[model samples]
Target chain A: MKTAIDIENVSFAYNEQPVIRNVSMTIESGDFLGLIGPNGSGKTTLLKIMLGLQLPDSGSVELFGTPANEFAEGTRLGYVSQHSTDADSMMRVTVREVVEMGRYPHAGLRRLTDKDHQIIDDALKTVEIEEYADRRISNLSGGQRQRAYIARALASEADLLALDEPTVGVDADVVDQFYELLTELNAEGITIVLIEHDIAKVSEYAETMACLDGELYEHSATSEFLKSGALERAFSSARAVSSRSVTRGD
Target chain B: MATETTRQRRELGAVALGIPLVLLAFIVFVVWVFPPLFELFWNGMEQLFNEHWLVSSSFLQHGFTAGVLIGFTAPVVGSYLVNRQMALIGEALAHTAFGGVAIGLFVGASIPVLNYPLLWALVVAAIAALGMQYIAVNTDGYADIPIAIMLTGGFAVGIAVISYGVVFSATVESYLFGDILFVPFENVQLMVGLTLLVGLVVGLTHKQLKFITFDREAARLARINVWLYDTLLIVLTALVVVAAMQILGAILVAGMLVIPVAAAMQVTNSFNRGMLISIVFGQIAVIGGILSSYYLGIATGPMIILVAIGIYLLAIVR
Candidate 1:
C-alpha cells in the first residue's frame, strides 16, 4: 500500500521547550487515522507540519511520495483548521464562495471555470448542503458551518484531507453525522487524518488511532488497541480525574 | 408563499427603479445646471478649459480627465489601505508631503535654477512616507508614535518654511486648498499613467496581498516574502497619495482614500465588490463635488471629500 503520509524524527519547539519530540508515524492511503492528545500536546502543530504550513526542526514530512517542501502547488491536499470560526466572522460570503476558495490552488490567477463550479456543486451536494449553497456562511449554525467546511475540503478533490478537531463545538448528534460523512468519504478511498480530543469518539470513528503526548504512545488498529487497554494506559490520568469526580458526586 | 413572492417583486422593483433614478439625477445635474452654474463662478470653468486653460481648450475634457484620473487610482490603492488598516498612515504621509511642498517653495525662491517645484515636493514627501514606514516597522514600543511625530513635525516644518519667506504664498494657498482648475495637461497624463500602473500591479499581486492580510502566519509559512510585499504596498500607497494630493491637496487626500472604501464595505459582501463599488462612489463624489464647488465658488478638494463623507453617512444610515 502506498503511504499517504510519512513523518520521520519530527520535532518542534517554541523557544526552548519542545512541544513535539522526535515522533515518527506513517499513514497508509485510504486510512481513517485519528490523532488524539491533551490540549497543547502538539496535535495541531504536527498536522501543520504535514500541511507544509510549519517547519519541523529535526526531521522531514513526505506527503504522497514527495517531500513536503517539494510538493507541487495545487497538489490535492485539503485542510480544515480548528479556527474555522475566523472565516465565519469577516465576510458574508456565500457557502459557494467559501467552497470556491478550495479550488484557488488550481485556479490560480484565472476566473473560476465551469468545471470548478461543477465540482463545488458536487461537493455541496455530497455534504448535503446544496440547499444552503447560496445562503450566507454566517447564517449557518455551528453544525451546518462544520458541514460546509467539510464540503469545502471535499471540493478540493484532495486525495488527503486533514481536519484539526472537526467535532469541536458541534452537538453530539451532529458529531455522529459528521463521522458518518467522513466514513462514507473514506469508503470512497479518500485518506482522512482527524485530530480530535474525545478519545471515545476517535475510537468509534477511526480505523487506526495514535495517542500522542509530547511523543507517540500507541499506534495500532482502533479495535485491538481498545481491547488491549492501550487507550486506558495512555489516558490513565484523565480517567483517574473523571472517576474521582464521579465518586465525589456519589 | 404568495406574500413572499410579492415581497421579492417589490424589492426587485425598488432596486431597478432606484438605479435609473440616481443615474438620471446625476445626468441632469451635470448637463442642465452645470454650465449656467459654471458661468456664475467668475468663469473659472471657462478659464479651466479656454485660452487660459491649465491644459487645453476643452472644459468637459479637462473636468472629466481630472475626475477619471482621481476616480480610478484612489480606490485601487485605497482597497489595500482599508484592508491593511493603514488609512491613518496615508493621512500622516499627506501631512509629510505638505512639508515637502513647503521645502520646495523655499528652495525654489532661494535658488534661481529650480523650475519644477512640485516635483521636488513630491520627492521629499515620498521620502518622509518611506521613512515613517521604516520606523513604524522597526520600533518596538508604540505603533502610532512614529506617525504622530512625523505628522506634527512635518507640519511644523511646513509652517516654519512658510514663515521664513512670503515669495510663493498664493501658490502655497492653491496647494493647500486644491485648485483642480490649475491641474496641467502633463500632470493629468502623469496621474492617469500612474493610476493604471498601480492598478495593474495590484491586480497581479492580489493573491499575495490578500494572503498576507488574511493570515500573516500562513503567508510567512508559505514563503511569501511578507516584508517585501508589505513595503511594496507602502510604496504604492505613497505614490498614490502624491498623485492624489495634486488634486485633493495634502489636508484632504486621506479622506478620499478612506471614506469611499469604508462606505463600500458597508454594502458589499466581498473585497472585489467593495473595491468596484468604492470606485463608482468615488467618481460620483468627485464629479458632484466639483460641479457644486464650481457653482458655489468654493475650494474643490474639501468639497469633494465632504461629499464622500456624506455618502458614507448615508450608506450607514440606510
Candidate 2:
C-alpha cells in the first residue's frame, strides 16, 4: 500500500512552547487510523502539520510522496477541523453552496459544469443529506452538519480525509452512525485519520491506533496498541505534568 | 471520462485566454463606449420624465448616476467584507483615501497634471489596503487593532496635510462630508468604469470569495490561495471606497458598504440571495435618498445612509 501521510521527527511550537515534539508516524493508504490524546496533547497540531495548514518548527511531513508544504493538489485531501461546523457564524450560506465549495479546487476560475453538479448531487446522496441541500447550514443539527462536511469531502473526490474531533457535540447514537460512515468510507479505500477523545469507540472502529502526549507513545494495530499499556503511561504522565504546572503557577 | 477531461481542458484553455481578453474589452467599453451610453441613458430618462430638471440638469444627472453605481458596487463587495467580520476595514480604507485626497490636492497645486485627487486616493487606499493585509496576517493581536489604527491614523494624516496650508477648498469638505451635487461628468465616468470593473471581478470570483468568507480554514485547505483572495478582496474594497468617496465622502462611505448587506443578512438565509437583496436595498436607499434630498433639502449621503438604516430596522422586525 502507498503511504498517504509520512511524518518524520516533526516538532512544532506555539509561542516557543512545544506542542508536538519529534512526532514520527506514517499513515498507509486506505488505513483507518485513530489518533487519540488528551485535550491540548497536540493531536490537532500534528494533523494540521500533516495537512500543510501549518509548518512544523522542525522535521518534515510528506503527503503522497510530495513534501506536504509543497503539495498543491488540494482536491485530493479533505479536512474537517474541530471548528468545521460554523454554528456561531452569521454567514447565511445554503448547504448546496457549502457543498459546491468541494468543486472549487477543480473548477478554478471557471464555472461549474453539469458534470460537476452531478458529482455534487452524488456526494449529497452518498451522505444522505440530499433532502437538506437548500437549507441554511446553521439551521441543521450537529450530526446533519457533519454529514454535509463529509459530503463536501466526497464531492472533492478526496482520497484522504482528516477529521479532528468530528463528533464533539453530537449525540451518542449519532456518533455511532458517524463512525460507521467513516468505516464505510475507509472500506471504500479512502484513507482516514481521525482525532477523537473516546478511546474505546475509536479502538473499536480503527484498524490502527496511536497514543499521543506531545510525543508519540505507541503506534500499532488496534489490538496490539490496546495491549501496549502506552495509553495509561501517556495519560498518566500528562496528568502529572499538568498538575505540576498548576502547582508551579500557584 | 476522456470526453470530460477534454471538455475541462477546453474550458481551462478558454479561461486562460478569456480573462485578459475580457478585461481589455471592458477597458475599451469604458473608454470609448460608456460616456455616450451614459448620455443616452440620461437622455432617455430626461425624455421619459418629460425633460424634468431632475433628469435633465447635468448636475443631478451626474450625481444620480454616481449614486446608482455606488449603490450596486459597494453592497456587492461589502457582502463578503461584512460577512468576514472585516466591516471596519472599509472605514479604515476610506480614511486612508481621505489622506490620499489631501496629499493629491497638496501636490497638484505644485504640479499641473497630477491634480486628480480621486486618482491619488485610489493609489493611497490600494497601498494602505495591502499594508493592512500584511499587518493583519503577520502581526499578533485582534484583526481590528490594525484596522482601528489605520482608521484614526489615516484621518490624522489627512488633517495634518490639510492644516499645512494645502488650499482646503469646499472640494475637500465635499470629499469629507459628501455632496451629491458636487460630482463632475468625468468623475461620473470614473464611477461607471469602477462599477463595471468591480462587477466583473466580483462575478468572476464570487465562488472563491464566498467560500473564503463562509469558511477560511476549509478554503485554505482546499488550496484556494486564501492570502491572494484576501488581498484581492481588500484591494477591491479600496477601489470601491475611493470611487464612493466623491459622493458618500470618507466618513459616510463605509455606511454604503455595510448597511445594505446588514439588512440583507436579516432577511435571507442564502449568501448569494443575501447579496442580490442587498444590492436591491442599496438601489432603494440611493434612489430614495436622491429624491428626499431634492424635495427635503437634506444631504444626499446622510439621507441615503438613513434610508438604509430604516430598511435594516424593518428587516429586523420582519
> Best candidate per lDDT, number?
2
Cα error of candidate 2 at position B254, Å: 0.8
Residue-level lDDT of model 2, residues B1-318, one tens digit each, is: 001234444655786788798878877887789889888998899889999888998999899889899999999999999888888899999999999999989899899699988999999999999999999889989989999999999999888999995576797999999998889877887887788878877877788898888877777787777787799999999999998888889999999999999999898888889999999999999999989988998888899999999999999998
Model 2 per-residue lDDT at B172: 90
User: TM-score of B chain for each model?
Assistant: 0.78, 0.94
TM-score of each: 0.76, 0.95
**Clashes in model 1: which pairs?**
none
